[model samples]
Structures are given as structure tokens and as C-alpha cells.
Target chain A: NAGVTQTPKFRILKIGQSMTLQCTQDMNHNYMYWYRQDPGMGLKLIYYSVGAGITDKGEVPNGYNVSRSTTEDFPLRLELAAPSQTSVYFCASSTGVGETQYFGPGTRLLVL
Target chain B: AQSVTQPDIHITVSEGASLELRCNYSYGATPYLFWYVQSPGQGLQLLLKYFSGDTLVQGIKGFEAEFKRSQSSFNLRKPSVHWSDAAEYFCAVGAWSPDKVIFGPGTSLSVIP
Candidate 1:
């Protein structure tokens, strides 16, 4: 099974351009999260979903938005890309709270 | 707010030498601790985790960690280092409900032959 899959492994966007980073998991996990990793920094949570139709902002969710319409999908949207938004983004899922998370390869974004 | 810290930004070791990566955390009550490794160009993978019971926890790839509550530390250790073990290691702290995790800046390991 494809544990967690993210689309567009690499992307380049212009300032003010919008795009969505897609994430899917076949494991049927109830908890999903989006995180970004900058150079020399630990992963920072952008958003998280408890279940379908339930979402919440995380530590760093300023320039992003997320929606969970189905259990297998949680997509993060960047409304207006900026240089600061350029980073490696990861998607993770787990069966429940306190469970070990499975991470996707990661999407590297560059805003020009 | 809960947080994790990896003191070493990078560590280099001769192959077959002992290795340790330090991790310190700040949290109230009991903490669930975890270690994850990321190979270059690869996603992160779980190494081990500590919730309760024994303070010493064994993990994959001949790695282990000791959770010291009094010191608020969970440091990863290996008896002998392998070249294949070179990767970035991260320490994380979390709980059961709410399931929010805080990750520390990773420690990159390099093994020289």
C-alpha cells in the first residue's frame, strides 16, 4: 500500500501565485498533518486534521490553508506564494493520537 | 508549550566507534518521546519512542535511547557506528490526545571509514 503520497515532488511558483500541495494515504488514518522544514530548522506544523471535515491550524499556518474532504486526502493550499513559503513540505498520517506517524517523501517548493 | 532540542547540529564519527546524539525536552507531566531518522533525499522514519515503563528503549538499526525524566533528556546511542547509519536524526515530543508533536532541530550524523 502507498502509505502516504504527495503530488508534485518539486515545484516553483511566482510571488502571488496559488497552488495546492496534495497528500493522500491509503492506510486510512484518522489523523493527518502538514509540516514545513526550512534550512537548519525543525519541522513546523502548518495544519492538521483530526478526521474528515475537521481541521485546525498548527504552529505555522499563516500563509496556508487546508481542507479534509475525505479520509484519504488532506490538501494544503498556498493562496499567495512568497519567498518565505519556499521550503520542503511533508505530509504525515497516523491511526490515532499518540500513534507513530508515517510520512510522505516531501514536496520541495521554491517561490520566485 | 512542549518543545524538543537536539544540541548537536552535526556529528562525525569513525566507523565502528560509539555514537551518541543528545536530546533535551521541556514539558509538563509525562512526555511521549520519539526519535526519527531521515536519509538524504528521503522522508523521515521512526527510530524509537518512549512513553513510560522502562527508561531505556531499543529501536531499529541497532540504536537505543534513554529517557531521563529528571534531566528532561532522551539521548540516542549506538554501540558501534556504521557508514550506512549516516543520516539526520530528529527528536520529538508529543502526547496521546490532541496528538500534536514538537520536533527538534535535527542532528546530522556522518561516518568516516
Candidate 2:
């Protein structure tokens, strides 16, 4: 299985530009999550979905939005990119809350 | 709220030497703990996790962690270090219920010959 997959391994966006980061999992997990990791720092949760059509905000969800249309897909949307949003974004999935999370390769974003 | 802390920013150890990475967490109840390793420019990979059962948990790559509830610490240890083990390690904590998993800053390990 692909475990988890993300698109556009790397991207560079200008301020105010918008983009969508796609994430897909083939493990049929019920829980999915979006997180960002800054240089020399740990990951911070941006958003998560318990299942299809159900999503919720995470610790740092201010500049991001997410939609889970199918159990295999969860996409994060950035309405207006900023310098602070320049970081590596990771998508993860798990069978349940507090369970082991399988992570994707991550998308490196640079906002200029 | 749950939080995790890794006291050491970076550590260096000679090949075949013992290694240890410290982690501390704060939460109201018993937390689900995890240790992950990330190579440069790569994604995080789970090394091990602690839910209940025994306090000592074994992980991949000859790594193990001991959970100490009294000190709120879950420290990762390896009997012998390898050059390939050089990477950034992160400790994370989560609640039993639906909650965000909190990750520590991370500890960068460097293995020397």
C-alpha cells in the first residue's frame, strides 16, 4: 500500500497566492491529519478529519482549511500564503484517535 | 492541554557507544507517547509508542524507550549507536480522547567514528 501520499513534493508561492495540498491514504484509515514542521522544530497540527465529510480545527488552523470528501482523500487549502506558512507540510492517517499515525513524504512550501 | 519537551537540542556520540534521548510531557491524564525519527529532508517515521502495559517499549532499529510516569519522562535509548542512526528525533504526546498530538522540539543526533 502507498500508506499515505502527498502531491507536489515542493512548491514556491508568492504572498496572497492560494494553493491546495492533496493527501491520500490507501490504508483505509478513519482518521486523517495535516501538520506543518518548521526548521529545527517539531510538527504542529493544522487540521484533522475523523472521517469523510467530518473535519475539525487543530492547534494551528488559522491560515489553513481542510476538506475530507472521501476516506482516501483529505486536502488542505491555503487561501493566502504568507512567509509564516513556509514550511514542510505532512499528511498522516490512523485507524483511530491516539493510534499510530502513518505519515506521508511531506510537501515543502516556500512563500516568497 | 498536552505538551512534550525534548531537553537536548543536539547530541553527539561515537559509533558503538550508548545513546539516550530525553523526553518529558505534561498532561492531565495518562498520555499516549511516541518517538519518531526523521532523516534530513524526509518524513517522520515512528520508532515506538507507549499506551499502557509495560513501561518499557521496544522499537525499530534496536531502539527502546522507558516510560516513567512519576517523572513524566519517556526516554529513548540504544545500546550501540550506528552512523545511520544520525537524525532528528521527536517525542510526541496525545490524550486518550480525540485531541491533537503534541510534539517536542526535537533532538538532533550525530554519530561520529
Candidate 3:
């Protein structure tokens, strides 16, 4: 099964531009998460969903939003892109709490 | 609050030499630990995880980690290093709560011939 997949491997956005990063998992995981990684740094959680129709903010959720309409999809939305938002975004899914997470090949965003 | 830290930012070892990457975590209770590897321009891959049972946990790619509760540390080790082992390693700590996982700054490994 395809563990997790993300769209638009790379993107460049101008200031104030908005976009949605797509993530999908076929493993029927109950938990989905969005994280961002800066150069030479670890990942910081942006948002997560425990299940369909339930989403919550994570550590660095100031500039992002998320929705979990179905168990297979969790999308992150950026209302206004900024330079600080330029980072590698990863989407992950897990069976439950404290379970192993399967990660997608991240999307690299560049805000100019 | 849960947090993780990798003391060494980068480490270099010759091929066939022993290797170890240190990780420390802070949590109020017993924490679930994980180690992940990331090759350049690639996604993260789980090397191993420590949930319960034996303190010494074995992982993929000939890697193993020992969880020391008293020290609040989980260190990854490999008996013999190979060039293919060169990658960035991240240590993470989490609990039963959703979105509570915390990742440490990765430690980059360089294998020399």
C-alpha cells in the first residue's frame, strides 16, 4: 500500500500568496500530522488530526490551518505566505497514539 | 511538556568503526522513543522505536538503541559503520496524546573510507 503521498514536491510562492498542501494516506491511519523542518533543524509540528472532522493546532500552528475531511486526506492551508514559512513540509500518519508514523516525501516551499 | 535533544550536531567515523548517537529527553512519565534516519533530499525513515519491554531495542539497518530511564537517554549504536550509514538521525519522544511528539535537532553522520 502507498504509505503516504504529498503533492507538489516543490513550490515557490510570493508574499501574501495562499496555497494548500495536500496529504493522503492509504494505511487507514487514525492520526495524521503536518510538520515543517528548517535547514539543519528538526521537525516542528504545525497541525494534526485524530480522525475525520477533528483537527487541532500543534507547536507552530500560527501561519497554518488544517482539515481532515476523510480518514485518507489531511490538507494544510497557508493563508499568507511569508519568508519564515519557507521550509520543508512533511505529512505523516499513524495507526494511533504513540504508534509508528509513516512520512511522505516532503514538499519544499520557497517564499519570495 | 515533552522535549528531545541530540547533543552532537554532527559526527564522523571511519568505515567499519563503531558508532553511537546520543539523545536525551524530558517527560513526566515513561516516554515512547523513536529514531529516524533521513538521507539527503529524502523523506524520514524509522530506524527503531522504544515503547516497552527490554531497554535494548533493535532496529533496521543493523542499528540498535538502548533506553536508559534513569539517565533519560536513548542512544543509537552500530557495531560496524558503512558508507551507506551516512545520514541525519533524529530522536523523538512522545506519549499517549495526539500531536505531543517532540523531535530533537538531528545529528548528521559522515562515514569516511
What digit string (tens of lDDT, one per residue) describes model 1 on residues B1-113?
67788989999999999999999999876779999999998789999998899999999999999999889999999999999999999999987664468899999999999
The CA lDDT of each predicted structure is 0.93, 0.93, 0.94
Give per-residue CA lDDT, model 2, range A1-112, as digits (tens). Answer: 8789999899999999999999999999999999999866789889988999999988889989999999999999999999999999999999998888899999999999
Candidate 1 structure quality by residue, lDDT tens digits, A1-112? 9899999899999999999999999998999999999977899989999999999988899999999999999999999999999999999999888789899999999999
In model 3, the runs with Cα more than 4 Å from the true position are: none
B72 Cα displacement, candidate 2 (Å): 0.6
- Which has the better DockQ: candidate 1, or candidate 3? 3
Worst 10 residues of 2 chain A by lDDT: A38-47
Q: What's the C-alpha lDDT at position A104 in model 3?
A: 96
Candidate 1's C-alpha runs over 4 A off are none
Q: For residues B1-113, what per-residue lDDT tens digits would candidate 2 score against the true structure?
A: 56788999999999999999999999988888999999987788999999999999999999999999999999999999999999999999988644558999999999998
**Model 3's lDDT to the true fold?**
0.94
Q: What lDDT score goes with residue B68 in model 1?
A: 92
Pairs in steric clash, model 2 = none
